[model samples]
Target: MVVPLTVALGAGPAQAASCSATTGPYQKQVEQFLGRPVDGRQSSADCLAIQAFQRKHGITPTLGYAGPLTWQTMYTMYTQQWAGTTPNKAGKCPTNRGRIACVDLTRQLSWIQDGARLKYGPVPVRTGRNGAETRTGSKKIYWRNINHWSTLYNVSMPYAQFFDGGQAFHSVTKSMWNPPGSAGCVNMRPADAKAYWNLLRNGDDVHVYGRKPGT
Candidate 1:
């Protein structure tokens, strides 16, 4: 059954000390809110801004990094809302058991969760477009090749975490927002893809749902 995740932004502690900052929605939002450069690269100056904001809001370390909690707090306040306000213990993940990566294509958001605990994401992702729309269903990551290549498209699909056939979670450019996305692949920025590479492994569950609006 397809379901939209109904997670409230502040339901959890928000910032876990070990969490790494993400780009797009998290980094970009934080940048605009702090008036920092929106080059999409997290810099030391950006960290300072984050830290300052965190301190002001009582987030520990003022670490200057936009962890999940910090991002959630900032995103909630800045946008005036989150994807959903109700606490969804299931998090729309396929498995109510082990580590699962949930991708909400409609909202361009992806997050990894270990049952009830969020491991990462709820960050922006670019999925397949129109004729190449990414298939939505539950699948296991059959393999992960950090330097995978697509002979069909002749393009690099780095940090490839494959689930259904050639469809994978791999790195793409910021311009992925443009026309003609990858050939059914779930695309992430280089850094985020790397992070996913580090966190996920073969046999992990991937639950993809919702439609990519323009596709």
Candidate 2:
């Protein structure tokens, strides 16, 4: 039972009018992320732009505050967008291993490649939190359960592809941008998880590297 989640964007004119003016801790980073002037101060334009981004990505308050979570989301978006075609340019994920899934925990992004050719994503993912970090290094997709129910956590882990013990690639109903991160599994958007299910199979190589921020 894969219950899909939908995120609505764009606030009403009334809501839009509530954009905050007070500068946030991450104001400068937010401005730079949004391509605004990196003045380290918040402006009306910066507020509106930040608010728009927040709304688009389902960030809370939607009040144009360039807070830490907002900045983190922006950073993730920036890295994912910047990855483009060459997500494996660093060659951290071995290209010699044909048809492998690459998880870059540092950037919270994942993708599938076939010996240097990009097959799937550079999509956003929520990995394990500080204590239960997603293990790095080489792994293999040992099993897949399309409609997996987690007995330990009592959650529906749709499109689960288990790579490491108790840690897998799965989709959650909640926003991937939320704080604190997942228990251990690499949590993906429902769509991306489904795509992974379709593209990957049991025994396919999985490679995870980099330390997720704060972990």
TM-score of each: 0.59, 0.79
Q: Which numbered prediction scores highest in TM-score against the true structure? A: 2
lDDT of 1 by residue, 13-125 (tens): 56332322434347777787788988876665666567667765566544466566566555544432354432234356655758988887766667788877778866667
TM-score of 2: 0.79
After superposition, the stretches of candidate 2 with alpha carbons farther than 4 Å from their true spots are 1-21, 32-64
Superposed by TM-score, candidate 2 places the C-alpha of residue 204 at a distance from the truth, in angstroms, of 1.0
Best by lDDT: 2
Clashing pairs in 1: 14-69, 15-69, 51-62, 51-64, 110-122
The sequence of per-residue lDDT tens digits that candidate 2 reaches over residues 25-121 is: 9988888878999998767777778878776667787778888879878787788888888898998999998999999998888999999999998
lDDT of 1 at 163: 96
Off by over 4 Å in 1: 1-81, 84-90
Instruction: Tell me the deviation in Å of residue 84 in model 1.
Output: 9.0
- Candidate 1 C-alpha error for residue 14, in Å: 48
